[model samples]
Every structure is written in C-alpha cells, then in structure tokens.
Target chain A: MAELTYRDAVIRGIAQEMTRDPDVVFIGEDIGKAGGVFKATVGLYDQFGPVRVRDTPISEQAILGAAMGAAMTGLKPIAEIMFSDFIAVCFDYIANEFPKSRYMSNGQVKCPLVVRTGNGGGARFGAQHSQSVENWCMMIPGLKVVAPSSPRDVIGLMAAAVRDPDPVIFFEHKSLYATKGEVPDGEIVDTLGSAKIVRPGKDATILALALMVPRALAAAEKLKSEHGIDCEVIDVRSLVPLDTKTILGSLARTHRLFTVEENPRLCGWGAELVSIAADEAFYDLDGPPVRITTPHIPLPAADLLEDIALPSVERIAERVQRSLQS
Target chain B: MAKLEDRAPAPKGSLNDDIGEEKRLALYRTQVVIREAEQRAYDLFLQNLVKGTSHLSLGQEAVAAGFAGAMRPGDLSFCTYRGHAHTLARGVPIVQVLGELMGRDIGLMRGKGGSMHLTSVEHGVMGSYAIIGAHLPIACGAAWRAQYKGAKDVSVCFFGDGTTNIGAFHEALNFAAVWKLPVVFVCENNLYMEYTPISDVTAVKHPAADRAASYGLPRIVIDGNDADVVYRAAIEAYDKARAGGGPSLIECMTYRYSGHSRADPAKYRPEGELERWKERDPIKLYRERLRAFGVGEDAILRIDAEVKREVDEATEQCKAAAPPALDILTTDVYADGGFAWRN
Candidate 1:
C-alpha cells in the first residue's frame, strides 16, 4: 500500500486510463504544460505530449463542445472546467448538448467522455468560485455525477467514470486535494453507483459525499463515544446512479436517517435521497430524516465565515446527536 | 446575363473547369432533390401532417448540396435546425427525412428526435443543433479528432447569419484557428436573423465574412444561389483543410424562403424581398447553368422528373407510417439502454 494525495490520485487515474487506451485525450485551460491551475494534472502533458494532452483557450463552451464532438466521433476525451462553478458558463453543453445526443440520435451517438472539475469550498475563494455545486450537475437527467472523498476513492471512481460509456461529471473537492490516504498498488478500478459503509453501526444511518464523507465519519465517531449513538456512515459516491440499496438497508437496521451535505440547502442532493427513503422506506424510518447542510446563502470569503458556513464535524455531530435524542 | 466568373469568389481562375461535368450534374441533382423534398415538407406542414414545428431550407438548397457534394464519404457535416436539405444532401433517404418530420416510426431517429435534431451517423450527418452557434465548437472537436488520428477527413459546420453573434461562434473560430484544426465553417448568410434583417442587429454589413479577420482566417464570400460557385468554394476549403491548412470560414450569401420556423408568417420581411430573392432561385440558376454548359435538355428533364417521383413516393411512405412505439419512451436515455437512476 502506498499513500497518495487526492490530487496525485487524479493524475494517476488519468494516466492509467490514457496509458490503457490511446483514444483517451485530455483538454482544458492551462492543463497541458502549466499542470492545471490547482496542479491536479501535473504530469499528463509531459507523458502524453501535446496531441493527447491539449491546452485550450479560456473558452468553456469550446472546451466541452469540442469534447462532445470528439466523443461523438471516435475519441474518448476528458475535459476540465477548471472550477465546477464555471460549469454554468458552458451549461448548454452539459444541460443540452452531450446528454441529449444519444437519446436525440436514437443511440446513433455515444458520448464516452469525462468532465473533471474542481468542486466544493472551505478555501475562501469567495462566492462565485467557492460554491459546492454538485447538486447542479446531479439534477441533470442524462449526466452521471461522482464526488470522491478520499485519495483511494478518487483514483478508483475516476477510472470507473472514464470506462463508463456515458458522460460523467467528476467533482473533485478543492479542500480534499491535500488530504492523503492509502491506495493499493497497481490498477485500482471501482464501480459507479456504489456507496461504501465507512463506519458500520446500528444506532442511526448517516449519509454524506465528497468532503462531507470524512466530516460525517468524524461526527459518527464523536456521536458514538460522547452521545452514546453508534451511527452508520455511508459515503454516497455516485449521485446519479445512487446506491439506494446500501442506504436503504442501513436505514432498515437503524430506523433513523441523517444526511450531511456541503451544498446549499435548497434542492440539495440529500433532499432527493431523503425523498426516496421517505417514499420507499417510510415504514422502516423511526422519525423524519434530518439533513445537515450549508444554509441557502452565497458562500462567504472570510476564513471564519466560510469555515462556519460549511458543515463541520462539530456541526454534524451536534445536529445528529440532538436530532436522534428528539 | 452575367458570366459565372463575374460573380464567383475566384473571378479569374481555372478551378471551375476541374469541377467536371459528372460532379456538376450530381450537384444539380442534389439541389433538385433538396428543393423537391423541402416543398413536400412545406406541403405536409400545411396539411398538419408534420407535427410541432420545422425550419425549412427552402432557398438554401445550393449550400447543402454544394458542401455535402464536396465532402468525402467519411467526412462529417454539422448544421442547424434548418437541416433537412443537409441531411438529404449527405444521401440520407428522403423517406426517412420526411418520416422524421411527420413523426413516424421509420424516421431517421425513429421520431424521437423529431424535425429539428435529424442525425444519420452512417451518412455522416452528425447532428442538426437547434441552438444557435452551439455546433461550431463541436465541429472543431470533430476536426481535432481527425487531426489526432492523422486522418484526412474534414468537419464542415453550417449555420445561419444570426449565429455569428453568439459567443460559441467566436469561441469556436478562435479555438479552431489557434489549434489549427481541419474544419470548415460555412455561414449561410440569408440576410435575415429570424424575423429581423441580420444587418439591423449585426455590427458589420457581413456577419461571418467580416469577422473572419478577427480569428486570423480569410474572408471568402460567394453567391450562395449558384450551386457551381458554392461547390467550387467548398472544394477549395475542404482541400485546404485536408492538406493541413487549418480552419477556413466561408460566408455563403443565400436566403430562406420560409420564416424562422413554421410558426412565423415572416411578416417582418420587407416588401419585394422574397420576390427579389426568388429571381435568383438556386434550382433555376443551376438548371440554366446546366443548359449553358451544354448538358443535354433530356438529361436535366430526367433528373427533375426522377426527383419529383422520389419526393411523391417519400411523402406517401411517411403518411402511411405509424407513430413510434410507446416503449421507446425510456430507451436510449443512457448508454446502458435503461433510464433507471437508482437500484
């Protein structure tokens, strides 16, 4: 086992796929020689050269449009949007173009591509740059949305996303890039739409994704020791093809549900999960599902303000502990 | 009347002679088929057989015919919702095009895509994007793919005058120019942007041609009503792109006979505008040109008669075809052939 940062795992995952298939190409702004703005794609350009690892102008529409075009023809391209917030700039390609290509063409077109964007907050990049907008992509019907919390899951899920015969929105949290975890050597291929039970417990079920997964895990430990509540924490990795089986099974055992989210509270991904559980597993629930999320407001830039705005371990632990007691 | 040389982009060139009689006759036939098919499509729309809405390329057949004729078999063609002509020009069956317009099971996309998004990968008709300026970058990507694979095929993207103002148009042009991708952007400057004249809202007199300099591309404009002129221009652009000359932007001055869509009566059109453009009808000009070129009258008559028969047959087949099956509602939503989001 080797320890890898979440950022390095991104490079390894892309390199692994590009090495396996010559058809895989990468395109984005400053992603070639500059190694991306965040240094996530540090070594791809030197390895693949300019033809495969292309640097594009600051044109989001062109980046995704070209990617869609390439994918439609023959190439399996991995496009980067720099920041997930900028996905709004080229939302037409995400919302209308690639997603609708297959259905509109009656399966004559297949968009086997991945759009990797730096997502989430706590870095104090201000309102426009620091929003956790995974919910924005998840709401789109034809897109597969995945956000990995740990370094190991990052490589595994990214490999799965690239190999899938569809367009996937891979959201890498800006905060989690420096986080480290042990990844097994050699190939690490994982499945999409599968959730991992990070902390197994029977008292109550706590669900989270991306950065919130670790926070949820930490909160679960605190709740178990301090509040005498052994909570089951599941990392909901893929939002589109959600792992409802594991979540619902956990809910059945614990008879209580809680969702930790980094996105604004309105129409968050957790709301959909809560609705699904309410409808399908209403009898299995002991009380109304509780959601611990950032309030519906623009993310602040101040260190204290941003840190408090985002759901932290203390906030999640307190909320779950209080909700379960009530 | 004035000679073809007087109006062509290359006023003094021997390139016209190289087009050959065989290709000229084929281009004429393609324009005739597009013209006949468009008229039948209008007729069906009038009878309420073509449901929803359609954007017709009534007077823009030459642009589709010329470009599609110039493209190789594996070469890709991307255009806007005004795409029936482009689809047929790429050799997609008239019956399937009509079937799609009428929302039939035998349509190009089996009625799922309806009239706007006509696509036939087998025929190299990539897609008909309804959104303006959206497919320009997509065509660049296709060209980039060919360049990556070291292939010689070029991607030809077509759009109307209104598309020039969209951000994607500028982004795609600059992107293609910077990357030196093998693609040709054809702007069918029909002088109108929906109901308003394109000149009214556009900064320059010529929307696409004038903006070519901004992207470091040559400004090549031609008379779109002349199929021979458009054909030669397309060949030149495609040849340059195939020879690793990078992207080229050619603005073809054509006109649309119908409104922006079936919903508009085109009341915004100035008086005598439609009549003035009709004088230079592509089919009429091509027929006269074919006669002038000494193509026998019998051959021209045969193509016209055959095209008329084909349109009638396609119309009948479309009328008899049924609506798509209900089970198709959930199919093709994902690559897995199922719409299930959770399991």
Candidate 2:
C-alpha cells in the first residue's frame, strides 16, 4: 500500500488508464497546459501530447457534446468540467444529450465516457463552486453517479467509470483532495454500485458521501467514546446504482438511519435513500429515518457563517444521539 | 434575369467541370430517391402509421443529396433533426430508414431512436441530433480523431441557419479553426428556423456564411436548392479538408416545403416565398440539366418511376416490422454493468 493524496490518486488512475488504452483521450478547459486548476491532470499533457490530451474552448456544452460524439464512435473520452456547478451550463448535454443516446440508439452505440468534476463545500469558492450536485447525475437513468471519499475509492471508481459502457459522473470532493490515505499499489477495479462500511457498529447507521464521509466517521468515533453509541458509517461510493443491499442490511442491524449530505436537505440524496429504505426495508426500521444536511440556502463566503451553514461532526453526532434516544 | 426554364442553373465551373452525365444523373437520382422517400414518410404520417412526429426534408433534398453524394465512403457526417434526407443520401437503406420512422425493431438504431436520432455507422451517418446545434462539437471530435489516427477521413456537420446563433456553433467553429481539424461544417439555410424567418433571428446579412471568415477558414455560399451547386461546393470543401487545409463552412441557401414538424403548416412565411422557391425545385432543375447533358427523357422517367416503386415497397416493409420485445426495455441501459433492471 502507498500513502497518496486523493488528487494524486485520481491523476495516477488516469495515467494508468491512458497507458493501458490508446483510445482513452482527455478533453477539457485548461486541462492541458494549465494542468487543471486543481493540478489533478498535471504531467499528462506532456506524456500524451496534444492530440490525446486536448485543451478545449470554454464551452462546456461543446466540450461535453464533442466528448459524447467521440465516445459514441471509438474513443473512451474522459471529459472534465472545471467545477461541478458549471454542469448547469451543459444542461442540455447532460439532461438531454449524452445520457439518452445509448438507450435511444437501442444497442447500436455505446457511450464509454467519464465526466469528472470537483464538488463539495469546505473550499469556500462561494455558491458557484461549493456545491455537491450528484443528484443531477442520478436523475438520468443511463448515467452512473459515483463520489469517492478517499484515495483508494477514487482510484477504484475512476477505473470502473472509465471502463463502464455508459456515461459515468465522477464527482470528487474538492476539499478531500488533500486528504491522505493508503491505496493499493496496483490496479484496483472496484464495482460501481457497491457501498462500503468504513466504520461498522450496531447502535445506528450513518450514510454519507464525499466530504461528509470523513465527518460521519469522526462522529461515529465520538459517539462510541462519549455517548456509548455504536454507529455504523457507510460511504456511498456510487449514488446511481446505489448499494441497496448494504444499506438495508446495515439498517436492519442498526434499526436506525441518519442520512448525511452537504447539499440542501430538500430533495437531496438523503430523500432518495429514505424512500429506498422505506419501500424495501420498512419493517426493519426502529424509527422514521432522520436527515442531517445543509439548509436550503446558498453557501456563504465567510468561514464561520459557512461553518454554521453546513452540517458538522458535532451536528451529525447529536443528530444520531437524538435518533437513538427517540 | 435568366429565363424561368433555366432558373436552377448548373454550377459555372467550380468542381462541375469534372462531373459528367453519369455523375449528374446519379445526383439527380439521389435527389429523386430522397424526395420520393420523404413524400412517402409524409403520406404514412398522414395515414397515422408513423408514431411520434416526423420531420420531412421535402424541398431541402438537394443539400443532403449533394453533400452526401460528394462524400467518400470513409467520411463521417452528423446532421440535425430534419435529417432523413442526409441519412438517406448517405445510403441508409429505405426499409431501415422507414423502420426508424415507423418505430420498428429493424430500424437502423433498433427503433429506439425515432426520426430525430437515426444513425448508421455502416453508411457513415454518425447521428441526427434533435437539439439545434448540440452535435457540432461531436462532429469536430470525430474529425479530431481522424487527424489523431492519421486517417484521411474528414467529418461533416449539417445544421440549420438558426444554429449559427448558438454558442456551440461558435465554439465548434473556433475549435476546428484553431486545430485545423479535417471537417466541413455544412449550414443548410432552409429559410426558416421552425416558425420565425431567418432574417428576424440573425443580425448579419449572411448568418452562417460569415462564420468561415470569422473563424479564419474558407467559406462557400451556394444555392442549396440546386443539387449541382451544393454538390460542387461540397466537393471543394471536402477536398480542402482532406488535404489538411483545415475546416471550411459551406452555407447552402435552400427552403423546405413542409412545416417544421407534422404539426405546423408554416402560415408565418411571407407571401409567394414558398411558391417562388418551389418553381426552382432541385429535382426539376436537375432533370432539365440532365436532358441538356444528353440524357434522354426516358432515363429520367425510368429512374423516377423506379424510385417511387422502391419507396412504396419500403413503406410496407416498415409497417410489417415488429416492435422490440418487452425484455429489451430492461436490458441495454448499460454496456458495462452498473445498474440493470434485474438489480
């Protein structure tokens, strides 16, 4: 195992994939010479040259549309939106274009495309940059949505996303990019729809994603030490083909659920999880599922105000303790 | 003014100098086949045989016929929603094209993609996008691949006059120009973008033709309704792209006889605009030109009758085709499995 940053893991995964497959090409704004604003795609431009590592105009619509086209043909294209918030600019491309072509084309064409974007709150780039919109990718049927919380999950899911036949939205948390973790030395091709129990216990179940995964884990540790609550934390690696079995099993054992997210509580991913658990494992629940999320307001620039806006470790632990008491 | 009989004159001498009677008649045959097939699709739609809405390229056959006719077999082409003519001209089988419109299992795209998304890689028709100018970048990507792989194939993107205003058009044009990719952006100016006239929507005198100069590439503004005119221009652009001279824009001035879809009747068009363009119909003009090139009237009539019969049989073939099974709906959502209905 090697200790690597989440960002470095992403670059390593891309380099290994590009080396393995000639058809895998990268396209985005400033991803070439600029090495990406986050520097995740650094050193790739020199290695792959201009044709494979393309620098595109500042039109996400065109970038994604072209990537969709190239994916339909023969290339396995990895398109990066500089920020996840800019996905709205390519609304038609995502909501209407790349997602529908495969199903709409029946079985004739395959879209082996990966849309990589940096998401999450903590970075304080304000509302435009500090947003987690994985739900947008989930709404589309053919598209796969995956968010990796650690360096290991990043490499595994990145491999799966690149290899997948349909389009996959890889939402990496910008704040977690610097977080160091132990990742396997060689190739790690993890399944997309499988959720992992980062911390397991029996008192309650806490489902978190991306940046929230670490917070949920920290809360779980605190709950065990202070309140004598044995909380199980499951990182939802892939949001689209959700790991229903793991979530249901965890809920059946814990008999309580607290879904955490950085996105607004209204119509967030937590709502979907609640619905899934309610429908499939209704009798297994001890109480109505609780949701701990950021309020439905734009992210503020000030650090203290932003801290108040988003859900914190203490807030998550208190919510779980309250759920257990109730 | 030239006499009405010789209104749609053949090109003076751009690339037409090499086009002999055989190729000229072939071009005429392609236009006839497209026109007949479009009329057949319209008739089917009227009879309630075609499901969903079908956009027929009634009078704009010359643009597709000329463009696709001039393309080499290895070349790739992408087009807009009203693209039956382009796909047909690219040599997609009549039965399969009709199967797509009729929503049958035998469609080129397995009936999933109806009229707006017909694709046949075998015929090099990449796809027909329903969005206005969304597929322009996709076409550029195909051309970029061609350049990357050291292949001689050039990519062509066909869109309407309105697509020029979209940011995708500018982005795609600028990308192709910057990289000098092997591509030909064909703008089929069919007079209107749905209900509004092109004049009301665009600011410039020539909306799409000026894009070439803006992007620092060669431009061709030709009479799109004239098959020979479009054909000559298409040949020049294709030649330039294949020679690594970078991308070029060919704006074909054409008109459509039908409404935007099956819904509108296009009552918004100005007085006598449709009739004036219709008098210089591409098929009529090409047929007269074929006669002047020493082709007998019997040859033109024979080709027309044969095409009419072919379209007639293809319509029945489409109607007879069965819809895909229920299980297929649950399947093929993902190529490399993430989530399937069984899960």
- iRMSD in angstroms, per model: 0.6, 2.2
lDDT for each candidate structure: 0.92, 0.85
> What ranges in model 2 sit over 4 Å off?
B1-17, B336-342
lDDT, candidate 2, A201-304, per-residue tens: 99889999999999999999999999899999999889877888899989999889899989987789899889988998899998989999999998997889
lDDT of 1 at A124: 89
- What's the lDDT of the predicted structure labeled candidate 1? 0.92
* Model 2 native-contact share: 0.51
DockQ of each: 0.88, 0.56
Report, to 2 decimal places, the DockQ of model 2.
0.56
For residue A265, give model 2's deviation from the true position in Å: 1.8
Among all candidates shown, the one with the greatest TM-score: 1
Alpha-carbon TM-score of each model against the true structure: 0.98, 0.96
Residues A1-326 of candidate 1 have per-residue lDDT tens digits of: 99999999999999999999999999999999999999999999999999899999999999999999999988999999999999999999999998889999999989989999999998889999998888888887788999999989989998999999999999999999999999999999999999999999998999999999989999989998898899999999999899999999999999999999999999999999999998999999988899999999999999999999999999999998888887
lDDT of 2 by residue, B214-252 (tens): 888755678887777777778887888888998888787
